[model samples]
Target: MSGSGSRTAAARAAVGAVWSSVTSACWRHWPTWAGWAAGGFSLLYGLLGLYWTAGGDGFPFAPVDPARASGSILEGSRVEVVAPIIAVLGLVGAVVAWLMTRRARPGRRSAAALMVFGWAAAIGLTVIVPDYTLIILVAFAPLLLVFAFTGVPGDQGGIGDILYWHRTNLIIVFVGGLLWATATLAYRRRARGACASCGRRHEEGGGPSRQTLLRWGRWAVAVACLAPLPYEITRIAWYLGHPLGVTPDFLRMMQDTPGMLEVGLGCALASALGGVLTHGLVARWGETYPRWIWFKAGRRVPPTLAIVPASIVAVTIIPAGLMFLWTSEARGTWAMYVPSLFWTVWGVALGVATIAYHLRRRGACRHCGQGPQPGPEPRTSLDQRQVRDDPVSAPGQRA
Candidate 1:
């Protein structure tokens, strides 16, 4: 009778837990509404952009004066027909993801669809508008917001709960944004410095060095924190130079050229650094300062903080690296046909780093006895006399 009663109690406890989880996940109103709104906007923009960029005869929606356009849409005389179209597709994906957030309601099907649609848009944008990665960047913006607000799989509490639940997912989105933005920035700077009219490259002291690689790593972290700043600056600078139509030729040339070299190196370095940051710092540091540090006290750090940032890096850098190969090529028939080989190599490196980072973070050391062990057995504290009496037994033996 007692055993049967205990079983019934355990069953009730399990059912209660599931019920709580369902309730937490289901509680919603605002997120659903915002998602629908964003999704709708995405669909509308995608159609307009695609129509103009792909279907229009020359430059779609060419306006005499863009600043004084009718209706809510901002008027622009010139638009990159192909690039803008690709961006519109990405926006469409974002809308789909938003709709999925509410409609699918955070189940396996919903998350999976979100990921698939997001990737499809990203790949399509990459192929159509290789030089302009902003579309891909825009696609992730809404997804990141979703991640920040959503609940994690194992999370079993309300908004005010101890764990932020989706913190790790948020970090991953951030890292992905950082890498893509860094790469974009680097491409921009390279274009500026390599402008044909400005100067020619010196043969000496040109190849990448160790210090250069280190700087690239720093660029990754900095850019991750302040994503899109470089792009905005470049855009602003371009606008300033084109004022009053005094230098149409010069503006056209500048726009045609790629970005600065520093930004490119920064992108590459950030890509590499993201791998290290996610896997190395989070996995090994776990509240413990570096061994070489002067301070000797042992400390405990929050696991989530360490895990999330690095996980984000691991997830994003690999994809960004792969995309970089074809996207980096100068526009031409030959450049278009060339395979994305270098980017693929870098992606492999990033993947390895990501895996290693997680492994180390999870305490999977052979010498440390930190990996998963046998069943949970009761532990007892003993006095000095008992320890002396037992001395030491075999590895599996109990006291």
Candidate 2:
């Protein structure tokens, strides 16, 4: 029994060691090689586009039923027209991303062009090429897990419908976009004579100060918080049979529809939760965990804890929110989609807020030997307090 326990312990130790090494590698290398990753993804995606153009059966969007395609930006699109263009752009993007990967000798013209291409591709892939399917899918993930066991309700064909290839394609695009954006940011920093890791200029006066980001971050947080309120109100109103945006009959129909009201209520709740979390961007508890939970109480919150999810939601929802506005235009039901219109703003503001939060809290960069370089005095007492107690500043030691 003693021998067996020793062996088990050894095995566990080996597994833990291997896992730790793998995670450490990923953490260190992923962002560093993000440009290469983007190039690879863009190249592959472009190839896929070419395949679709060559009459692949699994073309996602175009050639779907007219009823389904009616309200989308790609409504009247054709495989022949769109696929080749997408392929060309993807190939171009791949090349641009590749070039931007390493800045061995930076020429202003070359850097400017590459920057434009990289940023454009990043924004387009994240914000334009996809739709609300990504955000909605993420939001409804819990329900999807349940549906997997119990099956989806109503005419909504099983889990396959929600997790369809087309929707999954949006996720893929979203991932590529994230890679591109990360790559572009790094490339931009390096090109502009700034630290690639922390995005701070090494000059006399560095990039935007912590205080500046905090002040603007609060404004961004406010916008992010408010943007979702309209949607939440309308969704809850519809759920409660009030029909704030639509007709009474429409509300009744929605209520009558299997799981519709429930979904609406879920969305409203999610929106409310989003607003609460967005507030956390500027909140004390956001930077440091409150003394409420059992574990990690009063600990400095990991920056990635706030950044990753917020960034995902922020970028994914732009297209999702715009879907409502575009669909309303196609169907001529502006009032019905009014609440969702602000989702675009919500996404953009949340993105800005997330960036600000990151900027404010990112204590140091190992690559650039950059600590949060101090600059001008904060405008407000609150800013002073927050800056003084910044987790990046003191780590476990609170000021």
Candidate 3:
């Protein structure tokens, strides 16, 4: 009993220690990113917006005919109306972002206003304006490079032809939206009187506790795991010689296309792998390397190893799903795009799960000298000793 308890205690302590240290292993990290991305970038982009308002040529949001417009809300927006709005918002956003990141925290109402605007801009640029075009570009970028070497079967427009200035303009806008969103989070941490970097308070109540996040994250992980299953199923069916959603005539056409089965198999394998990796969000192996791994076994996994790729995939999924739903070649055909019904749900859930994973493992704030919140498990030698002596409690609670 004592031996088993000792091992349990060791594992628990090790997990806590490694999680706590994650914050320290960094590359000249900022206290909270300080809204620089939001403020500075907004200021620069706003100037461009003003230029576009004048007579600048590259205004990406010029009004399009409604029927031709895909799902993007920005379609049919006049340059005269759009440019000035972007200019004003960009100018105003710079000021708001600056105030948000200041050392002196703003009043409750002021902070609330800042957060509202920041989040609104984030959603507008990220979800409302952009369409599935971005999704196709990102997903097929690698393929384009490959095609560059082997040469596509048909006329392959190089990257420049496909990713014209218009699409690139939208990409830049998406990046701006991300900056504002992050700025909002940093501002919230500072305004709450917590450590800006880690958001840990000297006393409790900086925000939701670790336990709360864990509970919420579990649901998010479940949703994420399931969301991609539909897409995977459809692809797998095609690979197995039984096209699930496509009609026989359509399937024949697709089969006639070169590398059709290969492409379907590739997509299936990718989604399947993505789902499995997402499962690690709440698994023990996510916290530390398992014994099966060679040299690095038993060591704490670097948080970035899981976070970076997960973030990229999640970001890509959202717009692609939106595009499929709103306007695509599959508009009349249910079989082509029906499986993507839950893609947005998957992307959202994955994002939430990633946030929860960060919160759970990011030990304490080095700047403020905070630490992991106390767990229900026994801590001290005396506490462990007592539990060991008492057979009923010797096992203690799971970490």
Candidate 4:
């Protein structure tokens, strides 16, 4: 009897140790952490948001109209009560999935699925509310959740390695945003007969001209970079006007934070300008090497180098934009929630740029490529060169 009891205790301890080790390994990777954060934040935020939206006074944004009031927080409630609970469960499940990935456990696929569902739920809540801030946050949540699950590098085949890939994508997004903003502004300016970029219209039978797009894009980048400076001024005003938790206008004032949008917009503009200028430099003057430059590669950069960054920007911007659209309440004025507009505009620009970059990289025309054209039958699963040199499988491949 004594021997049997000791054996049982030892088995339990061994199991606990294995579980801890597995969970630890899973959390070490960034993608897993991203997924975990997205899942957890969404689960918590959504359920809480849903509860309040449905009239739980404990959470903010409870239905305020006395005519529609339910006597209790849970009063007159339907299955909407289950919404937050479901969100929490899904987020918890995603965390469990991350753990299982490291442990090589059986339920990882289900966990990943649950995380996806959780993000969907979060996005749904954002749309239901549509307050500008929540819309912006929720719009970005899905991308973050997917990234959280897949971006991290590990022995697990979860999402594969995407660290560098994500970074470069960010750069491309920056470029795209600049160009799109410029184009939009220029189009508006041309319509209004202001600004040289849009001073004249394109010739007959012409779509958006290349030079027009480029010129407009440059101006867009400049405006976007400057857009955030005003917000910074607002933040300074808020700091001076309000004391912590004391102002009569607390709720109204809270909505006015300047935040980091300005910095992000600026970085994006600079990056786009740099990419275009660098390419132009290489095209015009022959290889002009700086003192720190080690290689003589000039501007003929490898396709992967460009594609990876473009992909990162795509993955980040789209989800983020979606999260914003989902979370926002439709009540506020445009000026009150200008960030949403900026994000939406920039997000679309980044997306277009991503598609264009991939199309051009695939041996299409550099100046006019939009994307892969529709055709009858497809060739192989991948191009020959891509298969031969894929970093995932090729011998001595660089990450």
**Candidate 2 lDDT tens digits, 240-320:** 778676777777888888888888788889889888888888787787666576476555678899999998789778888
How would you order the candidates by TM-score, starting with the best? 2, 3, 1, 4
Better of 3 and 4 by TM-score: 3
Cα lDDT computed for each candidate against the true fold = 0.39, 0.78, 0.74, 0.39
On TM-score, the stronger of 1 and 4 is 1
Model 4, position 126, has a per-residue lDDT of 27
CA deviation > 4 Å runs, candidate 3: 1-34, 63-71, 133-154, 205-215, 241-243, 373-399
- Please tell me which predicted candidate would have the highest lDDT against the true structure: 2
lDDT tens digits by residue: candidate 1, 292-337? 5435323334445665555443344334434444342332322122
lDDT of 3 by residue, 34-101 (tens): 48777887888788889989989877766544433445556556889888888898899899888877
Q: Model 2 reaches what TM-score against the true structure?
A: 0.85
Model 4 lDDT per residue over 1-399, tens place: 999999999999999999999886753333324434443443454565556446564432234344333222222334455446644654554454334224232254554454354344443332222222222223345654776766633343433232222222223323333332332333233333333231333332333543344444344444434433333333344444533223436535454645333433444454455345323211211112222444532233454564555444433434334444433442243333454335444544544544433333343222234323434332333333233323333345435
Residue 136 displacement in candidate 3 (angstroms): 4.6
Instruction: Quote each prediction's TM-score.
Output: 0.32, 0.85, 0.77, 0.29
Q: CA shift at 210, candidate 4, in angstroms?
A: 11
Instruction: Using TM-score, give the best candidate's number.
Output: 2
